[model samples]
Target: MPLTAQQLQAWSRQEAAAAQQVTTATQASIWLTLWAAFTGWYSRPQVSDLAARSVRILQPARQQTGGLGAAYVREVLAGLDAVREKAPAINLPAARLGADLEQVYSRPAEAYRLTYALTEDTAAATTAAQERLFTLVRDDLTVARRDGEMLQMRASGVTHYRRIVHPELSATGVCGLCLAAADRLYSVAELLPIHDRCKCTVAPDSDTADEAVSIDLDQLYEDAGGTDGAALKRVRYQVNEHGELGPVLGVEGQKFQRQGDAPKGDPIARARRELAALEPVLDSLESRAAAGEDVAGPLAYQRDRVAKLRAITA
Candidate 1:
């Protein structure tokens, strides 16, 4: 069925909103089809460009979103070019459906399953992709830890061990740790691959060792929650008590041990110190939110802190 102009406009707005929410080019392409369907204005050139870019980013298997095969992308591009020359106002439903099908097939019903299988099982397609990428890097990588017992380096240059263990159910912990380290070490735009069973860990260069230090656990913990203290607590409880470690920790029973003996200070005193450091950040965030300033900037800091705090308290 040919979509009315009004319908097409509505779909375009929805697709734009979806695109804004996507964190990856692959995701954007998949969602863009929805926009095309709603708007009925599938500019072939734009769609072709988007498809090519998205295919380059996503895993090859994900390129087939709907039951449509990889050739569907080429077909869409060809159709778009033909329409540009002959039909200014053409039927877009079939093309839109093809694009949507590609998106559906490309997306994993369970993203965690796909990420985990790729990272854990060596034969998996995801693992192959990661290994292929690793072969391209030339940096000398090493494991850095505060205590020898806290982290262990595997015989395989690709794996590391932490004493504090969590299950790999979701990519949250793994992604959080990697992203935090990456943010400090490289620009945000730099691609950092993090996945379950990924062995990659970053440490300061030999010359930077004297200046390198573990991130402030308290500040990192507090910043995780921002103003949502209750939600933070719930997440902490889930990770610590409920055994819902998600994908960050990898497997259950893998623990990240503390490098040093427990601090001499009282527990209450430590809590007070942690809270003191966090209050200012939270206060700043609250003020910004109240003033209608973009709250996301502070919110990320708050969330990181909350994660750190949970690690400490747990």
Candidate 2:
């Protein structure tokens, strides 16, 4: 039997609620570790040591989320009798977390160095360092766990997924970037591109789903009322390769610091570069669409990317 829109939405909420519990615990662990490090609890107090300690605190939380992720996907597949296979386990090696944490730790280290040189007060120096470390640690820890779950979900029987933007899940509400992506379906092979503190969860698409549920962006923009056409055009959804976290969602002008890239060129140049890379994909989609494949969603997305690229290059 095909699942109704309401049933799909209900499942999304249930999965999101379960994921939120783990997110809360992981964030709590980050805060507790940061508090202990800033205080005199750690005798050494090196930034490297702080990163190591934070990763250690988060290991159990990561494992829990991974397990939940596998179970969630397994249950979803089993419900549809899609496949009898088990969902793959998430393998977030400690070394990977440590490497990423080391980069985040650098911000606090630089803050402490600069502040101590200027202020000459140990208390002020430590406070500045703590303030810098707080956000980085929280965002990193949260995203890392989410990324691991996403990886597991992709390898599982989930072929397609849709974004669920529940404003109540986030205190700040949804951002325009996420709002722009709300109406589309994404393949599970793609990373659920996220910004820091993104509260959106994904609903797995059942082969027997009766309807594609999504937010109406046109109505949403109309309610806002002041954004002009140019402003609207700025909401280009493209994924950039992040140095630590693989593919991250960003708008047209946003630049990502790739792990081993030389200095990124100007925005137009980057757009051209991306367009060149996307050409083969667009060709493949066009071929598929012409053959009567139901590829309207993906084709529209690619066409939009090409249009945006041309606009930039112009």
Candidate 3:
């Protein structure tokens, strides 16, 4: 007999398999990195090269940058371990959403019973959830690395960290959130990434912080007072957590904040939320374009805008 929608939704076999993959894979990768860091540090000369020793012992810092730190390795490991525990919690909501969707679509469209995209959408959403879960894990690990390595620097008399975002195609010619704040040097613990997916590398900054610099500008502009003459290099539209384009009034040290009802933390999550909010408009625009209307130009422009917004997280 064919199972009813309720019966199908109640099935856990698929969910179990998917969840297990996300959980185990994340844990394995983290441990593997830790093992490599341990081996590298352990194999190095144990003499007075405390800085070199800190890199391997702290681990993630070595993975992020060839940097070192001390006294915080145990805490950082515990923090990274917590990412595994967070996986199931993240998966649960995705499971419920998938189940509800399957229930609705695994039924008859007319008198004759039918089934359609329900199963596929459910699976796709679950996979998306798993990918996002991994993103969170990576973000947490980045923050942990910064924390641990900062301790090592503090102990070794290293003073500052210069935030450097590894440039990629999407981020070309743009300063990400952390890099925006790199106008002046920061204390070892200070120059960490402001938010998730912010893989800005913080190397030991030799330049002193709070120093004055001079520059010549050809045009008059908003003169936000700072000793360093760090003027706006370029202007890119700022999108908040809700994915709405709003005023960024952004200076080097000021972090971006979402206005309106957008959920806080993780700009990418906000952008996703914004995209979801725009579905009706997107569908309409797409429909118009398909019907051979003039929406192609507008649709393309809107899509390009949204794509840039989405890439903020990337």
CA deviation > 4 Å runs, candidate 3: 1-120, 168-174, 189-191, 207-232, 235-314
- Candidate 3 per-residue C-alpha lDDT over 1-314 given as tens digits, one digit per residue, 9 for 90 to 100: 33222222122122223323433455455334432232111112321242233223324322332122222222222232332111111111121112232222111111010010112132343344334334434433444445445555555456665543332212232243433454546665443534444433333442211111111121112132231225344432232332211112244344555445455677788767666555455567678778988645445545765577667746
Residue-level lDDT of model 2, residues 228-271, one tens digit each, is 53555457777787665555678877777777767666888888
lDDT, each prediction = 0.30, 0.60, 0.35
- For model 2 the TM-score comes to 0.62
Residue 60 of model 1 has an lDDT of: 36
Model 1 lDDT tens row, 78-181: 33233221112111123211334334322221221233222323135333333322221111010011111111111112122211111121233222433233
lDDT of 2 at 134: 59
* TM values, all candidates: 0.22, 0.62, 0.34
Which number leads on TM-score? 2
| Residue 128 displacement in candidate 3 (angstroms) | 2.7
Which pairs of residues have clashing backbones in candidate 2?
none
Least accurate 10 contiguous residues by lDDT in model 1: 138-147
